[model samples]
Target: MKRKKNNKTGLYMLGGVVFIYIGLFLFDSAKALQAVEEAFGVLKMVLPIVLVVFFLMGLVNITIDKEKISRHFGKESGMKGWFYAISAGVLSHGPAYVWYPFLQNLREHGAKDSLVFAFLYARSIKIPWIPLMVSYFGLSFTVFFSLYIVVASLLQGLVVEAFSKAKR
Candidate 1:
């Protein structure tokens, strides 16, 4: 029942967007076409990344056992869990929003809130940007900044863990 309600809500939102677009088209066709073209341009850039993330998610669902996820990312996972979360976050590419669903899936399977927060926070460290960062900021500053980010990720995770516990 709850899932159905969510689906309905999503559909309604999409409908609202469509309606607005229709109104835009009626008012000014030129602007509407430009808006649509811009929308499609964004979609074209995002589609491949979205497809890859979904494909990886499907592979995880089929090949990896839920129990394993729980074991590695659950409350009892300790430092090992932090390692996994940070590693996954650092390795993950594309927009941070793109990983929300995948992270939600992990959470549903018993991953801890702390781990999730850590993963999201660690996404700040972009491996591909390291070279550019070093060139502009120097290797020492880059290294220190990266280390600071990791520490900050851990701190964020711990804060989230405390809040979750308080709520419980």
Candidate 2:
């Protein structure tokens, strides 16, 4: 029932060129292209990872226990509810866009959109990424950022619930 999005890489590239032209008025053309190409290269690698992760997640989702998840989530206990929100990230990996289809399916299956959003924010704060971040930002920065991610993700879920109910 949903409309599919067309591939818009050409449009994005064209827009990038326009932005590059304007950027050159204040910056260097060669440097800008190098920066753009570097960014594009990152995207090129990221897209495949995203696709693979999404596919795996989609398959796992179809094969898993929906009833148990539904039961646990429908409860009123605060800690349990919060735990469900946090634990959602246990399976999610890769970039944000990769998780959209899964989240959309969750929403269709009675998942609160806020929880789905929070789950996503939590995914970015993964413990696996900590070692790399620790080497770059030191322990304190990594710790604080991790805490911020958890809190923000929880708050995002809450806000999403508030907005959805309000809209209703």
Q: Give the TM-score of candidate 1.
A: 0.80
lDDT of 2 at 112: 55
Misplaced by over 4 Å in model 1 are 1-5, 23-32, 135-141
Tell me the tens digit of each residue's lDDT in model 1 across 58-165.
Answer: 877888777888789987788999999999999888889888777776776678889988999899999999999999999999999999999999999999888888
Best by lDDT: 1
- Please, what is the whole-model Cα lDDT of each candidate in the order they appear? 0.87, 0.69
Location of the lowest summed lDDT over 10 successive residues in candidate 2: 69-78
Estimate candidate 2's RMSD in Å.
5.3
Q: How well is each residue in 41-62 modelled by candidate 2, as lDDT tens digits?
A: 8888778777776775677478
Off by over 4 Å in 2: 1-66, 72-78
Residue pairs clashing, model 1: none
Clashing pairs in 2: none
Residue-pair clashes per candidate: 0, 0
The superposed Cα distance between candidate 2 and the true structure at residue 14, in angstroms, equals: 13
